[model samples]
Target: MNTTPFRAGHVAVIGRPNVGKSTLTNALVGAHVAIVSPRPQTTRHRLIGIASYSEGQIVMVDTPGLHRDFGSANATAMHKWMNKAARGALDGVDAALLVVRAGQWEEADEYAYQALQRESLPVMLVINQVDRIVDKDQLLPYVAEVTKDREFAAVALISALKRKGLKELTRDILKLLPEQEAIYPEDEITDKSQRFLAAEMVREQVMRQLGEELPYATTVEIESFEVDGTMLRIGAVIWVERNGQKAIVIGKGGERLRDIGTQARLQMERLFGTKVFLQTWVRVREGWSGDERALRAFGYHD
Candidate 1:
């Protein structure tokens, strides 16, 4: 019999935006808990996803990608909050996963690298998106170059999209976890609530449909969520910063809005495993992103 003591630890996933942090978190936990988009700054919050194992559980935190600058005056607030949120999650975590795209590290990645260096904790250098590397020979030099600068307790070369080499990474993470009882239930995949996930699903569809400045300007708030035995009644407001953005979200004759709702509703059904009646509206919340008070009210940050 394996007599090893139970282990549990929190691991923060940090990197540049779109480095597959959310995708990797989903693969590690075996569920979709964080939102993923091709757009930079897509992740606006720090989400915790729990991965259960026979010997222990790894509590993984998916954080916003660190960026050098928030943005121009218009976008500064959102990305500023994102940087704070990502930094906040690093505190008190047992270990860290410093994710990087397969063969290159850009300027935005420098922000993440700096943040990780500040933390006196064990970190694993996770080279994600390895599947994109058609030439395997080139990967070795890049990995070797990165490892020389910092001390990473472990190294995981895995394709988070293809789910390759994930088992080996999980094994290393398990070994690093401190001996302690599990903090969450065995079957729980994430600490996020259904309402939050529902909101994210809606936001994701909006991002996909809008596909530009529209995605950054949009935020989904679940105004009401009522559940009965057979179905769910969900009401959400898609908040935008300007009147023009609102019209864009609403689309011609409300067709775009309708499309967003229909797609969100279908995804909700799959997530909740029940019939869903979802209502979405485009509301203009001017300067909400820049307004600290407004952001705090919307659960962004103080």
Candidate 2:
């Protein structure tokens, strides 16, 4: 008979842009609840990913990257919203994971650490992408330098993409959580709805397929998500800031848009475990990223 008590609680996964927070969350949860791309600020919302084990459940609050440019003159409404969403994830959480890239700690990393320090929760330093370091011996010195002045509840060197050092990380995180019943059912993977996930799946492909500047100017909205028998019919609008951007997304003879839809539909089918009929359209919404009303209309609100 098992005598150990089940532990479960929320843990805020906080870090700078593209530090593998979403990747870590998806890995721990054993599902693609959060989208990932090579671009910075790919995650623009507060998403919850639930990881269930026999002994505990980790309700991970996967947040947007904590960036410093939100207060800058060039910062748009979208930037401010993303910043707010990241900060908001710290509230009422049992612990926080300050994930940073291996062998490098920049100003943005320090900024993220300071933000976590403001919160009273136990902040664990997750040194992610450790597999990228060619010299493994230098890891200890790098970790020492980062942890020199800061107080961390625990430190973990992990390669989120490679799934290395995860069991120990999970044990450390579970130890920080209180002993209690699971917050979510064992089978549940995320707190987001199917409709929201559908929109994100499309946006993930947009970020993957488009160029640097165009992705930041784009946002996806699901115009329709309906279930017909065993298949899901999803229609998404890829909103760009200009007509020229729309032309770029559509490409010559609409190949780009079709590819986006095809990839996104396959992802949806894999995630939702059903056939998906996906339709995508590129529409222009000029300066929508800077417009607060437009941001709300496209579901960027808290």
Q: CA shift at 100, candidate 1, in angstroms?
A: 0.5
Q: Can you give the TM-score per candidate against the true fold?
A: 0.95, 0.98
- Per-residue lDDT tens digits for candidate 1, residues 96-115, read 99899999888777778778
Model 2 clash pairs? Answer: none
Candidate lDDT values, in order: 0.87, 0.93
User: TM-score of predicted model 1?
Assistant: 0.95
Predicted structure with the largest TM-score when compared to the true one: 2
lDDT (tens digit, per residue) of candidate 2 on 13-103: 9999999999999999999999999999899999999999998999999999988997577989999999999999998999999999999
TM-score between candidate 2 and the true structure: 0.98
Best by lDDT: 2
lDDT of 2 at 247: 93
